[model samples]
Target chain A: SQQGEEDPQALSIQEGENATMNCSYKTSINNLQWYRQNSGRGLVHLILIRSNEREKHSGRLRVTLDTSKKSSSLLITASRAADTASYFCATGSYNQGGKLIFGQGTELSVKP
Target chain B: GAGVSQSPSNKVTEKGKDVELRCDPISGHTALYWYRQSLGQGLEFLIYFQGNSAPDKSGLPSDRFSAERTGGSVSTLTIQRTQQEDSAVYLCASNLEINTGELFFGEGSRLTVL
Candidate 1:
């Protein structure tokens, strides 16, 4: 069973726009991490927000976590064409051997 | 130093045949993981190995899938009697013991079952 499920199966926006994607998980987590995947390549770690933390930022990426709702969101500011990729949210449980269970992911397309 | 590396960037095998995928973790990394991703789908956890202790094989879908890590560095995932459903990109990742939760992924091996 997948622990997390991301909303908005697909998204499209113009360059320089802000893109927001949401993820909902089933259980409590020790931490939640977001990753970006380009076509025919591996995933790249973007940012990680601990359960105790409500929000985190890395460059243009902003992530917020709401443990009460079991949901998280990743926001990309000033999006570019290169930001066009599939974004996934993964949850790591404190008791689950630190394994990350990934969500279905959201495909974002930024057209220049 | 290099990050995780997976051999045979691409592979094509007939259905019912066996295939072996290898992963070379970053030097000194103690935690290694394997995942499978289908086209336009999220990554699915397969198995995990930490040091010389027992591996966490709970994520393996069936008995046909098996993995082994030698000396806690190099790992191999073998799939027997491969089926079309097995076609996907197999990814390997590794992280230092202190931060086992942060994974550095490899380019991945794209497997295509005919």
Candidate 2:
């Protein structure tokens, strides 16, 4: 079953603009991961944020986790056309033996 | 393999037919997974195998879906008595361990039932 729900089912933004996507999950998670899928193909791992971490950054990508709210958000700064893809948030808990429950995903289109 | 590899990138078959999808995870990766994606349902986990032993198969929707891994390296997902609704992309992924977070995915097998 899917545990995460990503807001803004679809998003469109101009190149160099910022893109932000939010995810809310139901149960407690040991960690959360963000993945990007291009052309409905294989998913690429972007980043992983543990339950103890509040925020993390990698390059232009920034992810914030609010365990208190059972929510997380991904922010992309200076987005480019290549950044366009479907993003998914996966929630992982130790109780599940490390299996991840994924969200439906948020489709982002960056127009150049 | 440098990354997860899935065979029969595309499969087309009639209803009631059986289809087999193969997945080769990165060498030494003990964790493997199968997921299904369709128009109606999003990405859904079907099974998870850890070194030839599946500890989690609760995500499998029905008895028609089954999977196995051998030598802790390669895995196969078999769908029996396939229905039109079974048409979807079957994805394979792997990681170093079941407890690890990083998952490497394959290109996925696109199944079309006609």
Measured by TM-score, how close is model 2 to the native structure? Answer: 0.98
After TM-score superposition, the amount by which residue B47's alpha carbon in candidate 2 deviates from its true location, in angstroms, is: 0.4
lDDT of 1 by residue, A31-107 (tens): 99999999988889999899999999999999999999999999999999999999999999867775889999999
lDDT of 1 by residue, B5-113 (tens): 9988999999999999999999999888899999989999998888755346888989999999999899999999999999999999888862346788999999999
Pick out the ten consecutive residues of candidate 2 chain B with the lowest summed lDDT.
Answer: B37-46
Q: List chain A TM-scores, every candidate, in order.
A: 0.97, 0.97
The recovered share of true contacts, given per candidate in order, is 0.57, 0.67
Q: Which ten residues in a row have the lowest lDDT in candidate 2 chain A?
A: A93-102
Docking class of 1: medium
